[model samples]
Target chain A: MSSSELLQFLISGLQSGAIYALVGLGFTLVYASTGIINFAQGEFFMLGGVLAVAGVRIGLPLPLAIVAAVVISAGVGVAMERIALRPRRDSGALVLIIITIGVSMVLKSVARHAFGPNEMALPAFTPGPPVLLLGAAIDRQVLWIWGLTLVAVIGLTLLYTRTRLGRAMRATSLSHDAARLMGIDTAGVVMISFGLAAALGALGGAAVAPLTQTAFDAGARAGLKGFAAAILGGLGNPIAAVLGGLVLGVLESLSVAFISSTYKDAISLVLLLAVLFLRPQGLLGKSGREKV
Target chain B: MKTRRSVLATVLVALLMAAALSGCSGKGNGGSKAGEGGDAPYRIGAIVSLTGSYAGLGTPEQKAIEMEMKRINDAGGINGRQVEVIFEDDATDPAKAQAAVARLLEQENVIAVIGATGTSQTMALRDDIDRAGVPQVSMAGGSVITAEFDKNVFQTPWPNRIVVPFTLRALKDRGLVDVAVISDTGGYGKDGHDLILKGATVAGVKIVADETFNPGDTDMTAQLTKIKSASPDVVLLWNAGKEAAIVAKNIKQLGMAVPLVGSPGNGRREFIEGAGDAADGFRFAAGKILVPEAYGEGTPAFQVAKKFIADYSFAYGVAPDIFAGHAFDAFLVVTDALRRIEGEATPASLRDAIEATDGLVGVGGTFAYSAEDHNGLTEEELVFYRIEGSTWVLDK
Candidate 1:
């Protein structure tokens, strides 16, 4: 590929990669506090976009619609934790995982029925001609994704480093029993983390919806990709998941260009497999320190 | 690891379902099926993609089928035999389609089947349909449905082979020779891709570059960039479902100014809505039903399409999509055949009668089935549409 052509692919990859990062961050946040992989992470993403579309359809402004979507999705996340998991706190990991999958299925079915089977579209945050960067036409939505992602990461960092609640969540993630003994209301932190994770995922979905139209079942793919991103970065390691998402996106775009576009997923799989085999702890993850 | 397991499980179930499907169809024990009694309402079966990937297509198809069923029953019910439709949701999975077809054939004992909206589902269900000695009028528009013709499978929509030439002819008219074809690996996409390759070859057009994308891949900038490098005169995108709209955005995002011509699958309002302004100036060849006036005033095709659009909109409170028209046509074909059967409306009787379908005009245009040809629509039924000012304007 020529330099400009390569830049075009990279820019596109980053745009999508940002989505993966945000979704992955959701997974990381939930896993960090709860010690459970919420399989419905994708469903949360879907709810965000679907709700946003609904919001717009009902005459809300785009910004208000997005806020509504995030809030609703966060409420859904909390509901899932409270109704499904909080009662089954003593259940095995496999059972909890299965319940999350069940939650995802139920959410998908509800969306399918309520929304109908149409791809919902929302106007871009800024509508007009796309900006030209190095001969590559970049949709303005990509900037929204990157800027919001930056804000989210920075805000999350501040929360973790500057806030007592964030420290309590961290301590809980490190050792639930120890944190509880240290008088850290670990359950509240867990609930808060689930809400935060869902809000983050909803934000990602809203950001990407204009670029990629949201389908009722689009959540499964996003969820799987986000899950892959989380795993690639090592579960519970927030920073690494974002980087992992970027790396995965770039790898996918480059593979499509250099090899054949058909095998991009296969290429990603090979790379993911290689990573799992070679560095189980992920790039930025330390041994057992960040494991969920 | 979870994804891997799920993929493996899906494959295994698919293989087992295929095996069961073939066995179930090959058994010519239609007499022993549950719907054997001649006393009940005439049973028709429909297998539609109600949930999965093709749900958008199948939901409308299902709604249309229901509306048609109500109209038929209200209008004295196919020569006094009350028409009862047993609808099954395939979830757009081939395995699910297979299971649904089997249930329809073995349990419901439907005289004929009308859907499973996507090509893959239709293709998967065809073998069992043929084995049960039941005719299936498919709503999906894949060349493979009829190209590899089955005596029992009759397609109602204009297939890829027909739609491709129209778009290609338009491209050639504009002196656009070099073409870049992008196809999704989904059933419709793969079929249309291969046909576009053939269509371009037949038109003496050189393929500058071709790219394939899977269903869920979010970005096409890589492929578009490669196509830009090749500098094709125009790009032909042949993918069904929402992904095609995404391709339009990808084209806009990558600054690839090449004109995009799509298959009939991209003819839906969903595509235009999803792609937003990116859909501006996009063109494709689809059934005249999308633009009824294109068939011209007082023409039989135009009148039928106009009524369908009107009746569908009135009945459902929503503008009917292409798939709805396909389903409407298929339902009409089956019911129309049933009306002509001399004696009992058995599976065999319906099969032979459908095969003899002549000059049957519906939303998908005039369908005429012959001894060898099961797919009835031709290129004449298609019209060229351009997205201008966020509306589908028939290209004069």
Candidate 2:
């Protein structure tokens, strides 16, 4: 293939990679704090996009609509933890994971009813023609996705290292009993992690909605891809998850470009299997860490 | 305090369960057998996608069927029996459609089946229908429904076998010879993809680049990027889902200058609304419902279409799409055949009568079924339209 064609494929891959990274990061945060995979992470993403569209339709300004969507999604995350998970906190991980699957279904049904089962779109944050980079056209909404994802990563890094609540969360992820004995409100830290993860997912949804168009059923595929990315990155490491997402996206794009479009989705499955067999701890994961 | 909270939670759960039970019971309408010394209603089963991707097509189809049912029953019944249609929501899945047809045949005892809105769902219902010996008038447009003809299966909409060559001829007439096709891996798209490949040779068009994506895929840039490099004259989209809008937007995002053409599947309000500005200038070949003037003024077909459009618009506050027209014709085909049967309307007789339909005036066109042909519509019933400013303008 020509270099320009290769560049075009890379651009497309990076745009999708940015979204997978944001969603993967959400998976990592919740897995770290709660030890339960949140299958509903994608539904939060759907809620953000569709609710933002609804907000815009009901006369909210674009910025205000996006902010309202993210805030409401965070509230939903906290409410899910309080109402569904908290009462059954003593239940084992398997039961909790199944509950999360149920939550995802409920959220999808509710969104379908509320949004009327049609695809919805948000206007790009900056409306302009695509910028041409050496024969590749990059959509303006893609730039927004990349910028927001970078901001989320930097913000998450600072929170994990510099804040007291973040330290408490880390301690709880390490050992819930020991953190409680140390006088940390581990339960509250779990709730905060859920909120933060939801907000991040919603932000990704809002950023990509202009490009992909959001529907109630959009969550199932996104959730599956994001989960694959998390597992490919060893499931618990946030930074590694981001890198894993980019790699997966590029691999999928290149497969379509070089091999065939028929095998595009198979790339994720193949990568997950390869990672499991070859590098079980992921590319950047430490070898001695617990397998999440 | 803990006990009081638990009690409140129990009460809430009880209320929720009660509401859900009520909703389930209310879904099936007019299936009563207690008829107060009169004949029971003529039961017909309709399998539609009331809640999934094809919901846009099926919702209007359901509305059209329900409206016609109410009208037919209000006019002192057909042959002294009320017409009642039992509806099942397939949710746009093929397996659900198969299960629904089984229930309709074994439990509901419907005389005929009207639909399962999408192509794959319609195809999925064939086995149960043939086993039950009931007539099925499908609302989907896939060619296989008739090309792989079942004696009991008839279709209302024009199939892809007819529409594909018409579209290829349109492209050739405009001197846009090189074609790039991006079809979905679903039944309808697969059907169109095969036809386009075969028909391109006869229409003197070259296949420059052909790519496909699976259903529910959100991005088409990778496929479109490859298509762009080949530099085709036009892009023909062959999918009915709302994802077609994504293809339109992706084409624009990549700055591809070629015009985009589509199959009959792209002729929907959702395609226009979902694609927004990207939908403008899009072209497709479909029936005359979008611009009913193509039916020719003062003809019988024109009068029927005009009346249905007026009544449907008055009832729903929006114009009926081609799917609604297809539903109208399906109901018309069945009812007209019922009126023609000289003896008792049994399943075998209904199936034969539907196959023998002739020169019926309906919204789609004048349908005439025969032993050799089931999809009775012709190219004369179709017209081309170019979208402009969110509405279709007839393109001569």
Candidate 3:
């Protein structure tokens, strides 16, 4: 490939990987706090995109629509924690995972019925033509994606280090019994994690809605890719997860460029399999001593 | 609280499973033996993707069939046999479709089947349909549905063989010579991809780039960015579902200003609406249903097109899309064959009658079926249209 072409592919990959990072970060946050893989993370992403589209179409300004979408998704996430996760707190991991899958299906069905089967698109945050960068024309929406991703990462990092609730949630995730003895509201912490994770997912969706049209069934693929990103990082590590998402994005783009486009999905998956075989706990995952 | 919570999750899981099962099994319509003037209602089966990725395509087909069923029943059934239609949701799956077709043939005892809406789904059910010796009028856009003709299977709508060539010719004629083709790896998209590869060569167009993405891929920017480097005159996006819409928006985002041409799958309203402003200037070769003026005054196909559009819009409260028109054409052709049957319509007789269908007026086109050529429509039936102001206008 030419230099410009290579630059184009890299930029495109980073843009896509940025969205995956946000989604993967969501997965990591929930898994860290709750110890349950939230399969419905992508659905919250769908909800944000769809609701933003709806909100804009119904006469709200773009910024208001985005806020509305993020808020609504956060509300749904909190409700899911209370209604589904809280009730099933005593259930096994497998059971909880299955329940989340069920919840995902329900959310998808509701979105389908509400929005019909047509995919939707929202106007870009900055609706401008592409800017020529290093002989590669890059879209303005892609800049929005990168900028928002940076903001989310910084905001999340600050939330983790500089906030009382974030510390309490981290303590709860480490050991609920110890957290309880220290007078942390473990249940409330879990809810905050769910809400925060969902908002992040929604924000990612809203950011990318202009580039990738949002449909009712858009979640499954995003969820799978995000899960892959999370696994590529440690399952519950935030910093490595974002890096993992970028690696996957670049790998996928390069696969499409070098190999056949038809085998892009297969090749990325094979790489993921190879990574799993080599490093069971993920690249940056902390290995704990297991009695079993 | 513990037992109650456990019961709640169990109940929710059970309810979800039940919903999933019911979705798969599909609900029957007008299967009542209680209908008058019949010993037993002559069961006709349909398989459409009622709830899945291709649901946008299949739902309209199902709606058209349901509307036709009601019209047929209200008009005192097909030749007084009291038509009972059994609809099955294939969920856009091939294996599911094969099972559904088998169930419809064996359990429902349907003499004829009207669907398996998608190409792969139809092709998957082809074996069972051939074995059962039942007539199947398919709504899929694959040329293989009739090219490698089964004695039992027939096709409605212009397949990629006709659509791709017509589109390529349009591109050639418009001086948009170099083309970038992107298709999903799914069956229908692959079919379009193959056809475009062949059609571009025949139409004397250079393929600047060829790309494919998975069916549910959220972003096509990687592929689109690659295509941007080649700088083709136009882009041909082929897919059965909404992914192509993403391609439409992606092109604009990437500053790729080439005209976006698409397969018949993009002829639907949903595709246009999904693309929103990006839909403008999008071009495709489709049946005259999009621009009925192209049909002219006093043509047999024109009259059928006019009425089908009006009645379907009246029935569904929205303009019937190309897929709906495809199913309507199949319905009309099948029902017309039933009307022409000398005696009772059995699988053999219906197959013969359907094969003998000639000069039949339906929404898609005038299908003149013969034993050798099961796909009755030709390139003459198609018209090129460009989306202007979010509505398709005939490309003069």
Please report the candidate that would top DockQ against the real structure. Answer: 1
TM-score of each: 0.94, 0.93, 0.92
Interface CA RMSD of each prediction in angstroms: 6.9, 8.3, 6.1
Q: Which lDDT values do the candidates have, in the order given?
A: 0.83, 0.83, 0.82
Kindly report, for each predicted structure in the order presented, the TM-score of its chain A compared with the true chain A: 0.97, 0.97, 0.96
What DockQ does candidate 1 score? 0.44
Q: Kindly give the stretch of ten consecutive residues in candidate 3 chain A with the minimal lDDT sum.
A: A283-292
Number of backbone clashes in candidate 3 = 0
Per-residue lDDT of A131 in model 3: 82
Instruction: Please say which candidate is ahead in TM-score: 2 or 3.
Output: 2
Clashing pairs in 1: B47-B116
Q: What digit string (tens of lDDT, one per residue) describes model 1 on residues B259-342?
A: 998888887888899998889989888887777777889988888888888889999898888889999999999999999999
User: So what's the TM-score on candidate 2?
Assistant: 0.93
Report the lDDT of model 3 for residue B177.
Answer: 94
Docking class of 1: acceptable
DockQ of all candidate complexes: 0.44, 0.27, 0.33
List where candidate 1 sits over 4 angstroms from the true fold. A288-292, B1-39
Candidate 1 vs candidate 2: the lDDT winner is 2
lDDT of 3: 0.82
Query: Measured by C-alpha RMSD in angstroms, how accurate is candidate 3?
Result: 4.6
Q: Write model 2 residue lDDT over A117-144, tens digit each, in one string.
A: 6677778889888889998889888888
